[model samples]
Target chain A: MKSLIDFGAVKIYIDCSVKLAERNINHLYPSYVLEDNTVPPDYFVSLKYGGGIRRFVRKQVLFEQDSKSHFKPVPENHAYASFEWGLNYVVSNYAQEFLTIHSGVVANNDKAVIFPAPPGSGKSTLTTYLMGLPGWRLLSDEMALMLPETSYIQPLIKPVCLKNNSIDIAKKWFPDGKFSSIASATAKGDVAHLSPPASSWQQRDRVAKAKAIIFPKYTPNKKMEIYKLDKNQGFMQLAENVINLSLQGERGFNTLTHLIENTEQFEILYSDVNEVKDFIEQDLL
Target chain B: MSKHKISSQQLFDLLADSQNALDLSDSDWVDVIRIFRSESVLARFACQLEESGVITQLPSYATKHLANAKLVAQRQVSSVRFECAEILHIAKNTCEKLYLLKGAAYCLASLPVSKGRTFSDIDLLVTKDVLAQTETSLKLHGWLSEPLSKYDEAYYREWAHEVPPMKHSGRGTVIDLHHNLYLPVSGRAPKVELFLEGAIETDGFHILRPAAMTLHAIIHLMLNDDLKHAFRDLNDLHLMMTEFSKQAFWEDLLDLAHKSGFENELFLACRYCRHFFKTSISTEYLTKLANMQNMNQSEIKLLDRFYALALSPKHYLVKRASANFAELVIITRAHLKKMPIKILLYHTAYKVYRSAVESLLGKAFFEKSNS
Candidate 1:
């Protein structure tokens, strides 16, 4: 089935196999996907299984964009995961008009807060918890795209990808949260995706202004601690999370300095979601 | 390199006039942009739009892609200058002059073809005697050759025109240091001194003189078998030909190619440029080239038949059934032109043997998937 998915940032045509589509229990795409075939998608992506001897054995699913295979195929069961990662790769390379920073982002009243963290930092877990608040909006779970020289950060409301133990944690935190079944024994370990709140999709076109930069570090059984970063430290840390900073050249530097100079910057070490939420709700946003 | 089918009609129209892009349907525009991106020539098209002020009139979606590509192109221009400066700083110790080549040279010297141009590695030429010293100096400055198999190392050190590509340890910048113009074992490699004589220094950046550089660009395109980038390479030729089209340029280019035994390559390049891009070639020069390289209408026609299919974007959407046959013809000819029978046979046999072993072991075992 070839369907158009309007990701807000870029519209893509996804042609997927029946089995893979069936496995996507969340119906990941919005209803408008069926109505937009008349307009060509900015990207055309396909997910198909590699046919041959592996068909009877452990099948493999190949992800292609415009019929160009950028990455090797993964096992058949990992199709959805592979597709999401492939989309990430494409956006990171092709979407250079914005200063794309690798982070978990959520917004409140048009003000965006970035949670930039490395893997195993419980970034998505915290982002999921923050959105559970009454007025929080999910900007993106993976990256935040900011227009250069402006504080405007585009909202990309994709499913929140939680890895390993964080998968169960997110599910426990939001009982009514709709999530796909877990994919086990994968490269990033057991993985699941938590669909964003309905309101996030409703305001998908909203561009949030940058208000704060938060770096979260999840320590095992550690009390929540927040530390304010100096101007130099904040700017350098923010630049480290940027995907296309090198490609942006001097404009990237100007954007970062301007952003860090205006926004409140802090690094938080937190294990408790409740404490992190209180800090974001009461002190930050 | 990725092999995909592409509709070259879009590219042909856009290369001739950026305004043609506006006439494409949204679906067709998608294919054209992706193909140009894959071929590393989107920046050129983007440049055309930006320069002609057509960029402002396109849809936001189209304008965004162009805006993004133009930024990438600008970065490449700056990056080339920085990498060249670093190379010169290190090479100045032992090598007297560092002659930039291809994309790097174009950008540093600010040539017309330099607009929206980007390339993978920086290519530099030096005196053959000082090649070892320059390599050592580069090594001391942290530009080390990537680990290659013993056979591959032997190929680069002994048979290849350039040394093993040296990459900066920290910066990850790759540099291809060349002492000669072609594979020495190919029996048609040019003497390094002849090209060096025509080198000129522009604003402290040493580059081959316009005519010699044009001939070198032609040889670089025609001698290579990689049809994947041939279309973009042809466009580069078109830009240079338009920028340097004068009686003096044609005479100087021919004289250099004749001296270097690359007249056949030059003739083929001009023929394809005219065929694909409708590049303006003076009739006087065209006749002179035909006479210089033996006049062979039938052979030229046959090569044209192959290139017509092989040189377009390798996307499957535009591929004909016979494109594969044309590619095989072009590849076989390219390999034959690049190496002697003895070396060519060894290289082919080694590749076949390795692939057979790899397949037996399971080719997927070697592939790394992004998860």
Candidate 2:
């Protein structure tokens, strides 16, 4: 059987016969996916049992694009996790309509705050906390899609990917939030996903005006500190962080300049989530 | 080289005639989309269908992908323009004349080949006298040459026609500056000065005139060893012919080729384009070229068979069994024409050693992706 998830900017069709893939789709992506299965998918993804009965004792499953095998086979239990990564691979390569960034985005009052950072920088951890604040919505936890002509960020509305210790932190912060089973010792360390709130999924199509860019770093014992960043420095970081800036070319340059000119830029070092949230609300807003 | 179930021939036929869309099933559209993406011609396919007023007939899903493809193609068009302007600004102080070449020329001149075309490097042609000065000016403007070994540098400087490629430090775009079309060591290398006699100036930049432009495209296709871009090169030739055929382009092209001593390459380009795309040329002109050729009918027939297989789409899905063998033969011929036997052996040895070293150092040393 197949399921379809239309994440506003792109539609993905997930096809799988494995039990683990089915369960994860129902639990982690329920709010964003449509009940109707008729939507024509931009990409067809599949996960099926493989490796024969000898290794099938462990029940390995392979990820496929258009029914052709791709990537190495993983344990069957990780099939659902592999599906999301596969979808990202397709969109990051094919989606030329927007300049995608490796960032997390959360919005308040229809204004978005983009957190562009590296992998171990507590980006997803910050986004998870912001989703709990009043009048706040999660736009995206991994990919920030910025329209090149409009300077607006569209909501991707996928579940947050929490890794290692951050997975436990996410669960403790949002007790009621749903999460998928954790896969241990993977490439990015032990990984799990926290389902986004229903309200964020409800307004997934509402594009947000970009308000501030905060490059955050999690320092263990340091007090909360925030410093204003020069617009040119911000522009350079944004250019380096973008996944598809080359495809956007000159238009991307013009759009990014306009974005930096109008938005507040800052680099913050902190270990406490509450202090960061307070600063965003009382100072930056 | 992942294999696909269906061949690219069907997609090629559909692109050749958009009316054939009526016969494609939904599954066929999937295969066609893959082929177009692999060949980097999806935008061209979409634009052709839209121009024919048949885009409305395409399935909604197919049109969605085409719309995205068009957006990318549009961006590439603008990118080429911006790069050309920047190059002109840098070359203003040092070079006397700069001529745009190949895809950059087609786009800047607003020719037919610019439609839905995507390219990476910008190619420029200048006189041999200004070559050193041009390199110095470019370096002053932050265009740094790639680090090349002693042998490779000598190969480019002493034997190759073009100077070593330089890339802008800030923009990260490559520029290839050429003083001649063929290798200095090649037997078929033409008189480099004749190409400059008739040049067209547009927007304060010079381009090869229509006749020379088409001849250069032919020479590039026939003399080069790389067959990966064979399909795209053939399509470029087809587009160029369709646009230039309006004027006395053929006579001018033949005359230019005769003077440059590149008539054989021009003939091969025309024959292949005609056979593959049904490129329209007057039968009288075809007879004239055929009679002028010193090679007998059997030789031409054999060459046609070789190119027919080699020039067709070489994607994993559409590649014929004989395609690799055909490419090997053509490549050997190209090498033979490029250098004498003694020099060729040394050249091949140096290339192999450099390639092995680059691979061992991992791919980061050599920049690969053109786009």
Top candidate by TM-score? 1
Candidate 2, residue B96: Cα displacement in angstroms equals: 2.0
RMSD of each: 3.5, 7.2
Question: lDDT by residue for model 2 over A36-121, one digit each (tens)?
Answer: 44455676667776633413355566777655554666766667777777777777767766778889999999889999999888
Here the TM-score of candidate 2's chain B is 0.91
lDDT of 1 by residue, A1-285 (tens): 767776777677788873864457237555653455555577778888765554545667788887778888787767787788888888877788889999999999988899987888888888888876789889889999888988788877677888988887887878888777677778899878887877887788889998999999988799999999998899889888998888987888788877887799999998888898888778977
- Stretches of candidate 1 off by over 4 Å are A17-22, A31-35, A48-61, A67-69, A185-187, A229-233, B1-7, B203-205, B355-371
Give per-residue CA lDDT, model 2, range B88-122, as digits (tens). Answer: 99886677779989989999999978888778688
Record all residue pairs in model 1 with backbone atoms less than 3 Å apart, i.e. clashing.
Answer: B4-B314, B4-B315, B4-B316, B5-B315, B5-B316, B5-B317, B6-B315
Off by over 4 Å in 2: A1-90, A99-102, A106-122, A129-139, A146-271, A274-285, B1-7, B21-23, B351-371
**lDDT (Cα atoms) of all candidates against the true structure:** 0.81, 0.80
Fnat across every predicted model, in order: 0.44, 0.11
